[model samples]
Target chain A: MRAIFLREFFGYFRTPVAWVFLSVFLIASVGVPWFLGNFFESNDASLRIFFRFIPWIYLFLIPAVGMRLWSEEKKSGTLELLLTYPVSLGQAVLAKFLAGWLFIGLALLLTAGMPLTVAYLGDPDWGTVASGYLGAFLVAGAFLGICSACSSLTANSVISFVLGLMCCLLLVLLGWNVFGDLLLSLNFPVPLVDFLASFGVLPRFNPMVDGIVAFADLVYFVSISIFALCFNRVVLHR
Target chain B: MSAPHSTARIEANGLSKSFGEIQAVRNVSFSVNPGEVVGFIGPNGAGKSTTLRMLTGFLRPSEGSASIAGIDVLKHPIQARLRFGYLPETGPLYGEMTVVEFLRFVAGARRIRSVELDGDLIRVRKVCHLEKVWHQTIETLSKGYRQRVGLAQAIIHDPDCLILDEPTDGLDPNQKQEVRDLVNEMAAEKAILLSTHILEELEAVCSRVILLHQGEILLDESLEAMRKRHPLFGSVKIRVAPADADRSLSVFGKLEPFVERIDRQGDHFLLRSRDKRNVSDAVLAVSKDAGLALLEVAPVIPRLEEVFQELTRPQSKFIEEQG
Candidate 1:
């Protein structure tokens, strides 16, 4: 399992995918806040505007990183080789997921320079910044888990990417008013809509930006990761 | 064929597998003992790969069991997996990694660590002749080198058994011979089962063969026994003087019990018998009596390709019933 983790963790950098994902993400996460959110004009110490753009960024970029997790193995026929090993399926899935999660963590880590620049400019609330990063990490983990499961469903990387993108798009849409109204107008039940909306990351993520780390919010995101990974295991089992 | 003895290293007991409405393998069972090399031959989609997958525990059998070194593959897959190495179809590998990294990763997965791991890697690299491309990335190497690396990883642990699915699928003739040599070199100490559609491959490697067709075991016996199943198992050829050929043919026409079909070639007479019989002496006796000058006379050995077609042509069972 350790060998798999090391291989997958380093696997990101072996291709152009990692560098492209990192550079794009670093530029967008830092650039969005300054150009569109008016980071300098607001004259604020908090990184709330920066944290807000993270989910939008993750909604697009997380799938790109996670799409190759199982799809490539399936395409190259290595999935059979890996499953036949002495390692259990769960262990293999966990190792791969953690490798991808940590890769997103690294991408998140590279954006830390923004906070340092904020601190240099004004009196930044370091706790809020820390909690915000944690929120972003959890969201990344949840989205990555969904994408990894999507990758396990198909051998074609393009189909895997599209499926992951659609799933992540639905999760993000569950919290927004326009999507909620659209579902309600389609004669959806109120309680079911409320239950679905509770699974959305933005609802749980909004408070963490103000340094409010609710245990329920953490549980929700963690459950999403576990559920998605469990789904991945079940698909491979079939 | 009868089941192998209890000491067999790799065994499958009444294995069956199905995909939805279609059955891929049915009630198939065989075994390979130590120092035995078994060739598995079948056309595409004949469940050859399916059976190998079940034995390796890559696919669970729908209604059967497999064991490696006496451990049940389904019940205790890891233990069974530890006793044998499998090279799956396509020789799947991570092409991004160098040959060294690939072998080391496989060794680590198999729990061969520390100093022992290094030595095993070197040993396999030497045996597989992969020393030239040890540090080269797999994608940069040719298919032949990649296949050698595949074989190297399968044998790195030195397991008691080896299961190779089309180990030399796409290699040139020389590369194919090299892979065969590696398998033959290791055949003396391990139980080996390899699948191929090429009949001539069995000549250099396999002691026995299991012929599968449409998800059933049609034939499983010694290579010699399979050849004996050829329609013209004991055919004979006699090169005679053209002037005496007609008289020789008339003489052979009376040997009704020995000759099934007699064909006249330019200066030769080809005789196929209903059963295996010594017709060479009969021909010589007839030639002497008929005053024919016999240039050459010898028994004809059946070719593997002809024998394979005889046993496994489409609707072979129908052909068998008629025969």
Candidate 2:
């Protein structure tokens, strides 16, 4: 398991994919908040604009990082050699997932300069900023887990990327006002409608972004990540 | 049943696999003893790769079982994998990695840590002739060198059994010879199961040959036994003048005691006999008695290509007939 983790961790930087992902993510992560939102109306009291765009940014960036995790191995015929190693399928999948998650974590850390710049410019809400970082990290882990499962379903990287994007888009759309309206018009049971809405990414992640670490939200994200990783292992074993 | 000190490296019994409607392998059973080089020869799409995949635990069999050193491969694949080194048909390699880096990764995967890595790398490089290309990226190396790197990684762990599928698929004549020599050297301590389309390779290195056809073992015998059991053995060709051909040919049929069969084509008489020595002597004596000039007399040994064609042709006919 350690061997697999080390190999996958180094494999990310050995190719140009890691550099490309980091550069594009950093550009959008910082550039959009400062220029498009005008530094949150020049107030700098909170990272509201940055936190608002994170789910959107992650929709594309996480797939870029995780799509090739298993697909490339399958296409190159290395999956067979990997299976022949003395490692369980679950161990291999978990190792690869952790490696990709760590890579995105590193890319996210590069944007620490944005928070530092805000701190230098004005009295920003440090508590909110810390929680927002935590929220983004947890969301990135969730996105990676979902993308890892998609990656294992196909040998084509493009197909896996598209499937991953669609899966994430579905999760993001579930909690939107439009979806809630649609469910209400159908006259669905209130309890069922509320239960479904609670599963959405926004509802579960909103508290964390607002500087509140709820136990239920933490359990929800961790459980989804573990479920996705277990599904990835099952697909690979098949 | 487990033996603490048994010597068999691989054992399979009634192993079979099917991908949906297509049955790739069926009712196949074979075992490789220690230090034995068993050559697997078959036509294309004859389940050679599928069988190897099952033995290496890459694919689960639909029936029967495959065991490596007494550990059931399907029940406990990791243990089976630890006991064998496998080289897939495509020669899986990380093109972005240098030869040394790839070897290091494989060693790591096999759980060889920093302590024994240097010695393992030295032995693998020496055996695979990879020292020259150690620093070269895999993508930059030629096909033969890439194959060498693949082989180097396989043996880095010094597994007791090696399963190689078409190990010499794309190599020049010199490279092929070098690989053949390498396999021969490795076979001294490792039980090697090598599959190839080239018949000469089997003849040169393998002590025993397994001829597969239509997912079945058509023939499994030592090289010498294969030659002896071959139906075309003891066949000879003789060219004689037409003047004495009639008389010489007339006596050929009477020499059936030493001949298994005979075919006459104008002035050339093809003779297949059970007793090669007696047939040659009788032909000499008859030609001398009739004063017939014997132009050519030589034994006709059937090539492996012919044997393969004969084995596969019957199966094709069967399929066509069933259709």
Error of 1 at A112 (Å): 1.3
For every candidate, give the share of true A-B contacts it also has: 0.62, 0.68
Query: What does candidate 2's lDDT look like per residue over B1-323, in tens digits?
Result: 22333454887789898989998898999988777899998989999998988888888889989888778988988777888888999798888888998888888888887999999999988888888999988989999999888888788888888899999989999988988998898888777899999989988889988888778887788876566544556677888887767777777777778787878888888888764443676777777876788888877776766666655785543234223
Give residue B281's lDDT in candidate 1 (0 to 100).
Answer: 78
lDDT tens readout by residue for model 1, B150-242: 888788888888999999988999999999998898898889999998888998899999999889998889998787776666788888877
Residue runs of model 2 more than 4 Å from their true location after superposition: A182-190, B1-8, B240-247, B250-254, B265-267, B275-295, B315-323
On DockQ, the candidate that comes out on top is 2
Which residue pairs collide in model 2, if any? B260-B273
A12-59 in candidate 2: lDDT tens per residue?
Answer: 888899888889999998888778878757685678777777888899
Name the weakest run of 10 consecutive residues (lDDT summed) in model 2 chain B: B314-323
